[model samples]
Target: MTNYDSAFRWMKVKNGRLHFASIELDIQKNDFENKIVDDYLVNGFKNDSEGIKPWKKGLIRGLEFTLSKSSNFWTIVIKELQAPVLDSNPAIIGYTAILAFIEKTKIIIDEDDLRKIELFVYESWKGSNADKVPNFNKLIFE
Candidate 1:
């Protein structure tokens, strides 16, 4: 097995409901996150991880394509957005669409790797004039 031969459960929307799919993928460890964080610190904007995006987008795209053989590549856009979904006490259904699927999956990654993902995502959402991601100071957790 390769270093990143790991399994993660993925979910997609179909017929106004969630469709579950599982697959094993190869996740190569890299300094993508560290670089993003570093760039954010120095330049006030993180702009690395072009290498990791393909790997991540490919996994989500594959799962989405399997659910529906549509010819749209927007799934990658949503996957990369990682937008903030309000965590309410009752939890609104439609509003939590993307997050619900993500919370159900189990992926194997070292702390460093996980940290990288978090950093990259944070930087993406943290808003930078260079990237136009507006620092929305919006807290996601309730």
Candidate 2:
């Protein structure tokens, strides 16, 4: 089996949350108790969809938490998307928006991190699931 298949199969799915090592993509519920809640409330919720509403909420809340506490929030978002759970789309949306925000604001990200983000974006767009989500590539350029 491929590395992804092996790693994915080993991940624990509990309480609707995918646990990858120590990081948990808690899909069960949205925890709004975070420092960056204001940004998500003011801006992130505008992109929510009906089908994945809860997942989207959880994603935004997770982003808020990560942004407040993690130095490598971008990496966390990217890795979170690797989970083949129901909230993959939500995670994708969250990370795509984060990448677009970074690019638009000219945030000083490390070269390696930027390259990894670009690679992930390219692979995501080239995947079959690309049609199901917004055109993230266009958003990056916009």
Candidate 3:
């Protein structure tokens, strides 16, 4: 099992909403949050678009994610952006989208633990709510 295996098993669900405290703590302890942010900024944004277009798009989408308390990075990417559901789990995609959102918003998360909270949310969703596997054609031709 991976380091987060037990954490995933110990997920808490309250009021039909999953809580990610355990996973968030694990990510912070392992220092994966910085890697997630740096990778998203340097690789994800650059490879996804050219020039400032990606930044502008990220800001817009980020704001949308932030303002919609009912929506999240995974839902926005899947339903709004129509991103192809691929093999990579929701945790990774949600993490990047969250970083972009955090970048565009005044939400004051700690710089060192930036991705921790988002990771928790996404991980919890993946473990407790999301389908066991991704549907590659969920947004086919969209």
Candidate 4:
């Protein structure tokens, strides 16, 4: 697993307003990856009054994904050829967002192990919520 601690650098929420301390992308080398991360940084943060600013979308090698916040949960929808390929269960707005995205995409290939992945997601985000944004000290990704 690789740790992406810089993923949430300079990101936070204060006084019910989402804040992005910086938008520089010196860490990621790939342009596509940088674009994806940039889009998330620019549109992902939520302001209390306006809520989430609609669906934030991205496309990776023809695979399309969208990120949106509803209530306190973040929703990720992955699509192929404009058809829904994976509609993830709602995840709390923290590491759960990344977890859901990774797991749900994995499910597209490992459909037989659905229960296990679902369980993992449920266990990861069970007691989490949006009140506290986790420090991006260590985000493990395989």
lDDT of each: 0.26, 0.36, 0.32, 0.26
Model 2 residue 135 CA deviation (Å) reads 18
Q: List the residue pairs that clash in candidate 2.
A: none
Worst ten-residue run, lDDT, model 1? 34-43
Query: Ranking by lDDT, best first?
Result: 2, 3, 1, 4
Measured over all alpha carbons after superposition, the RMSD of each candidate to the real structure, in angstroms, is: 16.4, 16.7, 14.2, 15.8
Across 19-137, the per-residue lDDT of candidate 2 in tens digits comes to 32212221112244323222222121233346545344434533452354333323322223232443344335544444433443344556665455434434433345433443322
- Which residue ranges in model 3 land beyond 4 Å of their true spot? 1-82, 88-94, 105-107, 118-128, 132-142
lDDT string for model 4 (40-129, tens) is: 332233222232321111122112221221112232222111111122112223233333344433324334333443333234223432
Q: Quick one: best lDDT, which candidate?
A: 2
3 or 4, greater by lDDT: 3
On TM-score, the candidate that comes out on top is 2
The list of candidate 1 runs beyond 4 A from truth reads 1-105, 126-142
Looking at model 4, report the run of 10 residues with the lowest lDDT sum. Answer: 79-88
* Candidate no. 2 TM-score: 0.31
How far in Å is the alpha carbon of 2 misplaced in model 3?
Answer: 35
What TM-score does each of the candidates earn?
Answer: 0.22, 0.31, 0.26, 0.23
lDDT of 1 by residue, 3-22 (tens): 12333333334334333323
Ranking the candidates on TM-score from highest down gives: 2, 3, 4, 1
Q: Indicate whether candidate 1 or candidate 4 has the larger TM-score.
A: 4
lDDT of 1 at 58: 30
Instruction: Give every collision pair in model 4.
Output: none
